[model samples]
Target chain A: MNTRFILVLLFLFLFMPCPSQAEMGMGISGRTEALVIEQFPYVYEGRFSIHNTSDTACLYVLAVASPYEDVTEWVAVSPAAVEIASNGYADIKYTIAAPGGYTGDYDIRIIANGYALSGEGTTGDRPVSYLQTSGSLRISVNVTHNAGDASLGTTRPHEADAPAAEDPQPVDVGSQAYLDVPTDVSVGTAVRLRGGIIGHEAPASLCIVLSSPMGESYALPTDYTYTFREEGVWTARLTLPDAPLVERQIRVRPVRAAGMAGGAYAVAGGLLLLGFLALHRERKKGQKRREKSEARHQTTLSSISLKSKTLEGREMPKGL
Target chain B: MYQKTRITALIAILALLTIPFVWADSESVSATAGINPYAPSFEYVEITDTELSISSHLDVDREYYLHVHSIDKNGITDIASLVCTLFFAGDGSLSAGATDTRSCYTLTYTYANGTANWTSAPAGHLVEGDCSATPDGYRSRFIFAFSLGKIAIPSGDTNTWKVSVTIMDRSGQTTTYADLPFDVNDYIEWSGVPSTLELSSTCMDPESPWTLPQSQPVQAVVTSNVPVSVLFCGADLMYGADAIACETFTLETVATPAGGTVNTAYAIPGAIPTESVTLVDTAYGTACMLDPTLAGYCNNSAGIASFVIDAATGATVPYVPAGTYSAVWTFTLERGAGVTP
Candidate 1:
């Protein structure tokens, strides 16, 4: 019976939580958990969540022993990972850069250093006590290439509407695009300028500007301009002048014009009114001339008849 | 029955005699070398700087050659060498695809007076680096990394150093040594930091000293406007206690800067301060020096050292060792923005 009693006392001593001896009741509290992460082929980044579940406020930190000398103790926990304040609970997260193609494993221990108080009746008026605990978790990760929706070139399920062309967005250039011009054009050779807005289908007219290498500028007419109606493709052709063909710079701008049809209507209307007035005057003159001619013919006929009466009927029928 | 008893008694005695010998020899660090009794030949040695620290590795092969281009704060590799060991003093030099035991040789880096021979000597390859502040801003210091080829020291006797090292030049005659200190079979790692760098003599033990798991602080007045935090700091391994262990230290910014950043450099304090050197090959009677101080000199002269030879002969027979050597080195500052208060 004595041996059994001794055994019970030993068990209690080993398992019982230790209490803080300081008057301020400041001591360690909460539990610590370990994260065992496997390495990846490329740079691998991940975050570890540190949950605080203590009655009193506490601070938690992570300590790592690296083979590298550059790594040191008390590496400041990233502020973005966790929130810590006086007398408050928070979670700490760490975005750690795993060693490239790491074939080995390491231990990361979380230290929970804080203080709290026990219930008034729990420990013979010693209400304040420090609590500390720890747990560990292992992650065996296999490095892999995950071709998700974005990687497969499929639009995200909840993507917003694409922005307009005027927005200052960076666009990827095609491999075939180049800015090469002839050093010496046999004057009058038509050179082409190609520029385009990506992902848009519209007839785009680019204004081409030619400048000499010596900073001299001259304006070229756009009378022979052509537009590209295909999306993401703009081309403009221009005949080079005899001078400044060698080492010249060319620039193109897109032009958008509004209210261009109103002037054409006014000119067509005025031409139609003029044609109507000329036709009306010609009709009136023709009518008056026809009446006069008819009257004269009738009078001649009458005279001929009277004469015929005198000369008897001999030439009268013939003359009539 | 009498014959059987006698055989059993004889067997028991033999077993008793062998037991003590086996136990005595079991606890030795050295092995009765397996197939080839001699140490393996080093084909080459490569040095590189990783995100963690600077390290060196040895390649076990037949032939090796390395060129050291430059050395600065980044890492040092300005002097390279192509070492060849004439086994038995030309008894069994390396030939095309020969796999005979007689052709094999060994080399090592011997230690004495608390420092290794290659490390303490003045004329040997000495690559240094430093980071300093300039008017422009923080910039990385330059360092040279190198790879060199197969040359082993003949390992017939204990007195003969088992190392044959040769410093190959672009034009000058090659510097060759047949016997050297330190075992060629074992590799050495050299690295350091500028402030308060210590070479621990205990590092002669390969396994114990190679990895520095402890941290040492630099004793310098805070010069920067801000409470300067040293991000990446390194130094060349000092002789004596610290032999062959490269140490790197990094610190984060806990407080703000309070002063201007200071330029920190790691150099052999007692080295001669001449800026240029000229190497003369005796047979050709031609003198070549990449001297920046002289007219029509090369611009980026870092490791240009002069060695006056009696004569320059295209043949190895006419080769004589010139005593003096020099190299071009540059110092620059790093992390100015972090240093600003």
Candidate 2:
């Protein structure tokens, strides 16, 4: 076992001096994640780059698509097809014309299909073969027509989005997904909430509709301080575009003065004073009974003495 | 003869000094204090290509300029601070408030054999390329090489950019390459249309009046150079003496939400003699978005343009004179966003 271990260590040490080799492949290193626009009907200038570190020059064809949108038609690339020299790079440029009227978010995928130059051209056309190698990047197209629509979350470009169900409503959506509201707050304390589309991406401004205790909703006034004046478990409901219905209840606690309530203190003080008066009255009654019993004892003793004196007088006379 | 000998000695000293200057291109630096006056300059042989010209000099209206390069080595090194901080100078047109910002980048290299190496620029610095400088013994001088080739100009910046480059050595001495001006173009175009729409007797129903979709939708391209809108209209369909009025058809993108009635987003105007009606609009005139369920926020992605016939007018398929109705349809592209009232 020692000999085998020694041989393995020697073999690894000998190979450590050699430099590691790289493989022929492709990678993209540019704005692969986002292209968010607002108040469109204007152009959006975008860019990305392709790195083909292969020995032989390869040609790349680019394609943009989305499963649910026509983003491919909305975008155009200057050099949709490019030829990168060996160990070289090709910079790509694309434009997105965000139209007005309708507003929402979209996920656009830019796919680069690469092919070897020498492959096949029997008909003099670029040879089409089985996909040799490819690189792709997903760009989240977050467009809003409203100047100040809050977008709390941008799409995760790398991961595939959860497929939306038909008649997609926020039936199972949590309030935290749409609005960020506190579960607990003190009376007269301002409830600072932020929401439009809630997640990581911080939006500049949010459109809010605060619900009344009576279940009526009103566009929360800009200068409206969201303070809870009274104490109760009040529920506020909010609705967003595409029917994301989220309702959350906040437990509003009454204001405490110096860790105690004034009303409680008043009730406690009144109860203590009533008890003191009742005890004082009871003591007076007991004192009066004691005095009466002492007077009765005095009268009975005097009467007994008089009776005794008479009996003594009679007895004395009899004895004489 | 004594005077001539002194002049010859001076001449010999001068001849010996010119030897290093003559072979300075390939010559190694000596224990000398100063370098060649033109050793690291923009006017050097390898610095031949100075102008980073546009690809299409004739066409002055395209949004992006891909990979503008001056690959000619202009021997200087250690570039710091690459900022892409020029916004629309025309007017603050892009101010939609806070999320209106561009991106920052860095550079990394991978070898032909796949050995990856990181070449860094501080995060948020804009340039994306490899920059290297190796010192060649001289405390005051180092050999520098740059392979930078990218600048994505946004369409809103309509004016020329006057850029200035400054290079500094470790010894605090500097070289200045002044005034490299770059001009960008602005333009917009799109392609790919859907198959034809078919109309028939089965077109009208009071409950769900939308007709069966005939074909694919118009594939709209996104671009930053110019804003656009798609409009559609057709003549009256006539079948063997039977004529159907054009107002009977409607084009819309979104389906009606449950319980609430959904109106067609962009409806076609009256046929032929009637002015064209805008379908794909840039002036957020109609709905909030294309599909709220698909994208969480306010997004305007294009949807299938479905045609619906009006049943509210009391014209059912049986009540109207219907046959194989046909009319020539024409779609037009027009200036949108900025031009819309």
Candidate 3:
């Protein structure tokens, strides 16, 4: 019975969990679970809390690791070592800074390992002996450059429609009569002039006149005789020279001659029209003479008949 | 045999009991760096009306603001110093007594609460400092003003430099961060050339009766550190040589205030007397000269000279083709004129 009891006790001792293993089950928690760091030259800070779930007091060490070895220089974890009472918690801080001109993303891991303090110690300091529980925290830092200008992201509002072109409203320039002269005209070319008597009936003696650049005036015909001798922008006026009290003014631009002359096309068209009319007149005259001859023939035929009848009557019967 | 078995079992049990104690005694506590999920980010460097403060890259003749942070878990009480050094390519070291090798910095310790100010050193060096902490953590801030005017590079050339930062805590723990590379470049530059030159229009009709001499302005702009001259060569629509001379066009140079020195030189052979002048310069300067006789140098003062191409009746204008022509203006800069790389 004694041997059996001893064996049972030994089995129980071998199967029992280790003190460090029990402490290792404790969890480490952080106020900031994940981190995203900006590119170098920018500072990033993070905070974490380690919870000692087990009844045993624990000592912990903080270690940081990254695939980017250069990050170690820019990053730091404070309170590299810590002591916490059983079922108590402690806070850890880490700061990372990106070097100037550094940009991109980085993945870093922070690990907290808890060790069960064997002997009783105060909260201030304790001798760390064995590994108990370990927990890991993950963070990401993305570094970027700030935009130089704020106006770049803003959009301009849509614009309203533009105003329409101004109408050509006529203005009274203290004139009794005025000519509607074209704004553009060719030098040495005839241009039509249209006029209306303002505030009165048509002036009987009104005649259109054109003045050259040299101040030389020439009277124009009713049909088409207004001409300019020089190439320039000139003004035309409807003059009532006999009635000097009427005041009127008109202006037009007579530009230099461009391309082919307009008169050539006009002359060619007129000649074609005259030829067509003359041909039609000749055909009508010939038809009228033919009709007159036919009528005379008919008249002659009647006279002959009448003569024959008279002879017959005079000559008497079959003997004549 | 029974006694030996019992003894073996007892030793095994003893070893098992001691195993837990040994493991517990050896394990040590450790803390890991944590991550912050919500971090601020920007896409470009910040610029202010008065200055350019931050940038992702370095440019020659531009200012940049560099900020660094130092944090300690134990709560930073005092900082011994902070220093930054720059190393160029091809040996990774700055020359002895080179003032541009290192730039000092100023430190500002901001507690987690966000209230902060800075203490600056007369030079670029950073000295001992202290920091305060809030509910967040303890932090030391370092700021530096950096520029790239210390080095000379060729046009269209780029060079890389490495920067390193070293910091020390009051406890004598020295930490260094290094291997940050920056690129510097020089851009190619040229000035005083007009975007386009327009010539006079000619009548399409060969039988046009109205004939008076028609002329158009021809000008050349010169901006150079070295003596330079310009030659205007004309060709027909098919690039036929001697088209301007065959057309009997003349080039007359007109001196203006913008044109520091003016002369006329004729490069075309078998051309009639058209006023042309040429000049020589003993020093570097810009010279505008019109020479229909020969291609020669003008005075050495930077300026622009105006010229007129006289078009006679039935004669083609210089640099103007019958329909469309190409004008080739050759600009030559003298060698060894003190142009810096």
Computed on C-alphas against the true complex, the DockQ of each candidate is: 0.00, 0.01, 0.00
B1-341 per-residue lDDT for model 2 (tens digits): 99999999999999899886887865565555775433222331111111334332111121222221111123223222111222222222231111111111122222223232333232322222323222232221211122221222222323332223333332433454543334332222222222123343343432333443332132323222223344444444443344454555544433321111222344432222223345455432222222112223322223222333332333333233322333334343333344111
Instruction: For residues A62-115, write the lDDT of model 3, one tens digit per residue.
Output: 656554445445667777666677656566788876554234455565655444
Better of 1 and 3 by lDDT: 3
What is the CA-based DockQ of model 3?
Answer: 0.00
| Model 3 CA deviation exceeding 4 Å by range | A1-320, B1-69, B74-83, B87-89, B95-160, B168-186, B191-193, B197-341
Once all C-alphas are superposed, what RMSD does model 1 give against the true structure? Answer: 43.2
Descending-lDDT candidate ranking: 3, 2, 1
Fnat values, one per model, are 0.00, 0.00, 0.00
TM-score result, candidate 3? 0.22
Score candidate 1 by DockQ: 0.00
